[model samples]
Target: MKLKSVFINTTNCITPLGLDVETNIRNISKGISGIRLHKNLVYAEQPFYASIIENSLIEEAFSSVSSSEEYTRLEKMMILALMPVIKKMNPVFDEKTILIVSTTKGNITQLSTISETSAQSADLSLMAQKIASFFGFITEPVIVSNACVSGILSLAVAKRLIQSEACNQAFVVAGDEFSKFVLSGFNCFQAVSNEPCQPYSVNRKGVTLGEAAAAACVSANGQNALAEIVGDGAINDANHISGPSRTGEGLFRSVERAMKEAEIKSEQIDYINAHGTATSFNDEMEAIAFNRSRLGNVPLNSLKGYYGHTLGASGLLETVIGIESLNSGKLYPSIGFDEMGLSQALNIITQNEEKELNYLLKTASGFGGCNTAVLFKKAK
Candidate 1:
């Protein structure tokens, strides 16, 4: 089904860089890196660090939802960040607003404390449904929890639903909280970085894990005055679940399809927000895929240096980041890069520079060999 018009109405995020998009963009565009030492984590005494959202700020922003101590941090973050925005939309209680939420590690980060699953248990879908119920939506919310790609894929699903007229509108919210579960999983895979992640760097080692949550409102037609979701696509690597494709083949295919769906030629892409997780294999593989796509030279950058790998939220949040960058006509640098890696000629926007951006490309690759590409066109 062809959508008459599906546009991103409103977007917001809660990241380590800052609580909201405005604050996050201001710091990112200024080339500010947000990774810091997590003295409480296993290697906090050592050199490794993480990009964690300030606890105080999160408490302040999200306290209204779970005023008591019932809700978990991740749940509160989603509810608090989305409540105001959703209310502003003035949705009706009985209106069918589909909720497509994404998360790599949901409230499950805290599930180890409880063995039995119950209504009060912190099921990821329950967290999403709680938010939906609070907003008075009558539709049954569908939850998507596909590793880091969940967030981006959630948006892609929402866009399709709008195109199919399955719902009048869809609320895409995704989040992942930092926990020993996530850190240990990555650590077991040796994906922790001793320093802030440096994407596209010759000396890159591993990813610096981070936590965040984000929400975006998409409608059948453009109602809010903002960027439109012009093109989007997703694909599986079918190669590896934990590691990226050797030649970045899956990512390359995803980008190719996404650009085609948008009817955007490779040259038309003005900027690319790469899923540069700061890992040796991931970065190099992405480099190879991007180089093969020939869009690597499209003035690429990774916000991971600033916000770390926000996992699921990385895609939607970074899509928001790309829109902000395009609207402001500024390109951000890939933080922590001292040396260029691989033989690819992809130009990493290594400095905060001003440029006229028309279409910004956002790409994300995650576990299970999932990759997503979304092209957001600047409203002319």
Candidate 2:
């Protein structure tokens, strides 16, 4: 059977930089970064750099949508991100529509509280259900939580569901918030950067965690679409539990499969939105993967500098920015990058430039040796 075509209809994001996509893009164009140094003793004993959304801002914005204070910070952010997308698309919450929620940790902060309500609220499924019910979604909501790849992986899942005739439309939402649990976990791993992250730079230290929520509307209909979903592939190397494959095996395979499904060669890719976590291993692994996939020459940039590592929201949030880049015909610079630090050379975009882009590739690698690549084409 011939598969159905899928397109990204609308997108929105809630971040420390801004609430709307245009606002965030404008800030990014001006070389603004949301990551900053914070001395929250709850998160860490020492001052740390992270892109944390202001609680006041979230409460204020969410108050406009709903006056209820029962929603968690992450849930409020997810609702705010999806609210505009739903308003723009005005999609019918019928059997043909499906909702997908992606997150690395949902309401993990609740786990810190010693209460039955808090424990129940920490359940991923319950969080998904609450968000779905808030929007009156008729179909059962699907949850995607595969480490950092959950964001873009949710989009891939949406595409397959629509293509397979399971649903005609899908609303994909992803988010993760700052919490002591997350901070301690990264601190334990010694992966938290002291300053704003610098991707692909010799001075790079480690990742700067961020909190954000991003949403996208996917449908078979192409009207007013942002970009067409061309192809996607996800692979696992099982090389290590925490560290990525030293040889870039999983990422390389995932990129190869995505390009193959897109029916494009390495040269056809105009730009790449890489999963540059700015860590020693991740940056090196990506450099190796791109070279192995014969895409070493492709202009690539990582958004980690601007937004920090947003965990589950990083992939989808960057994808939203990437679609804007395709539509605007401009490439955003990789903020905080000063010099090449990878073993394999990559053509990293340094300064913002006007480029007529046709095809874009978005990639993400996560724990458990998982890597995902999704290809997008400029919608005609």
Candidate 3:
């Protein structure tokens, strides 16, 4: 099905890689791993390093927000990323466009402090409202807290909102920050890797969490979009919330639905940006998922090594990287990978930038067995 009017005008973000687009692309394309010992990891006595932006840089970028809570970190990120888009974004505020947000543990870092108080929860919706209000789109805010796939789900939500004529335009934002609560949860699952993840590799460990903030403007007029979002879909394994289907059954179905919506044959896809978290189970399952999805032997890359798994931000953050990759005619390699660890020899990008290709697939699978994939066509 042809989309009537969905245009992604621009993308931007602040991540562990860099502050802006150019620097991030440069740092990430080099396959640089940003994982290091967290200076404050002594709080939990667990060695966990995530992609954290400097507090001073963020303060300078997002002057409108202050307060050193989880919201502050993500708020600063969204404000910085939205700065560029807002500079060129021309839309009627409060009436023209709508705001959509996605995050698994939205501002939950503040919960442990306030949970025992009168306010038993950290309202992520309140934070979303604050963001939209900051951008002068204080009319309506759509919040999606669907676990890890929140980023892509936000994209699909924005696209559908435009298609449904609910709004003339839509601004999609996704972000997440590392916190003691988040770290402890992953630690409970024993999913946290001590080293950088080797996606689709033989000597793989578990996933390393990362923090990031990202936003994009999707409009109906995509004739000159930076990247064309061909098709996207989301599905759940229903097997286990925190674990993946050993057989990759749910992921296979998710890819199948996405291709069906794209109306494009599987072989036409050129490369795949996998949700290669470097976790032993995730990597193994995704390998099977991709191969069964008819994406075997396709050049694949994962940015987790450089950005760590940016949790909620991975979907959009990686999407931004994918777009940057297409625009620059370069493909990033899967970092920290030495051997082919998975059952099959899944072709993973591990060297210098490869030549630009037309169609590529970007996928993400997270807790709750949530699986998502989006196909993109490089703008000609």
Candidate 4:
């Protein structure tokens, strides 16, 4: 059976660098980075580098559209990121339109500062419902929080739903805010970076945490469509709880499966937007996976150096930017990378350059051995 085609209609991002695609792309093109040294506040004993959106900025943006004055930071950011896209599209919020929210730890910060309303504030379902209700969505919200892959997985889920005729359109919003709990948890495993992350680099230490919210509209008949979500594959190695498979078995299989579904050869890929969290294992594992899949020669770059690792938001956020790159015929450099670090010799974009991009591959690997690969074709 021929599957129905799904496309990303509109996109929005709320990041430290900017709140829209154009601004983020401009700053990224100029090599501007949002990751910076941040003083440890109830998370670490020392300062650490991360890409964080200013609370004041989030509030200002939220206040402009809302007046409740009681929304949590996470809610505010998610709403702000989603508002523009929904407004621009003016999509109907009927039963045919579904709201899918992807987040790792929704309102987790409430745990650090428990209050009388802490229980409700920390409820993921409640947060999802609140956001959906705000937009008057008739259907219940679907939550996808599969570690860091939540963002991209959400897109995959929406595509499948559209193809299944379960929904005519889907509004996918994903976000995660930095919190004492999240930072301390990563610190416990010594995965927090001390400086700006250098993904796919030999000198890379670890991942720098970040916070951002991104949203996209997906439908069968895409208006202002940027790219078509052609194929996707998700797999898990069950190797370890906190670490990825040493051989990148899961990632390799995932990439292979996605490419097969996409019906494209390795050489047909124009570029790769890797998950490159800059961690020792992640970058190394990706190199092995790409080489094993015969995609080692494709030019690739990680956006972590610019926005750090925004956990659940990274996949979708990067996918949005990748679409922009495809339209502009430009590839952004992998900042903070000066040399090859992995065992396999892989192509890494060192500087911004123009290229004819037709098919782009976005991959994400997260804890619990979860890995996902998504193939997108430039919309004709």
Index of the highest-TM-score prediction: 2
Best by lDDT: 2
lDDT of 1 at 60: 84
Which stretches in model 2 have alpha-carbon errors above 4 Å?
A: none
Given candidate 1, what's the lDDT at residue 330? 83
After superposing all C-alphas onto the true structure, candidate 2 shows an RMSD in angstroms of 0.9
Q: lDDT by residue for model 1 over 66-110, one digit each (tens)?
A: 576767788778876676568767765554578778887677665
* Local distance difference test values of all predictions, in order: 0.79, 0.93, 0.77, 0.91
Query: How much does candidate 4 score in TM-score?
Result: 0.98
| lDDT by residue for model 2 (116-161), tens | 9888889999999999999999888999999999999999999999
Runs of candidate 3 exceeding 4 Å displacement: 1-5, 41-43, 64-71, 114-121
Q: Which lDDT tens digits does candidate 4 get at residues 65-167?
A: 8999668899999999999989988987788899999999989988776676886679999999999988889999999999999999999999999999999
Taking the candidates one at a time, how many backbone clashes does each contain? Answer: 0, 0, 7, 0
TM-score for each predicted model, relative to the true structure: 0.94, 0.99, 0.93, 0.98
lDDT of 2: 0.93
Measured over all alpha carbons after superposition, the RMSD of each candidate to the real structure, in angstroms, is: 2.1, 0.9, 2.3, 1.2
Sort by lDDT, best first: what order?
A: 2, 4, 1, 3
* Error of model 3, residue 342, in angstroms: 0.9
lDDT per residue as tens, model 3, 355-378: 858787888888877888887777
* Model 1 C-alpha lDDT versus the unseen true structure: 0.79
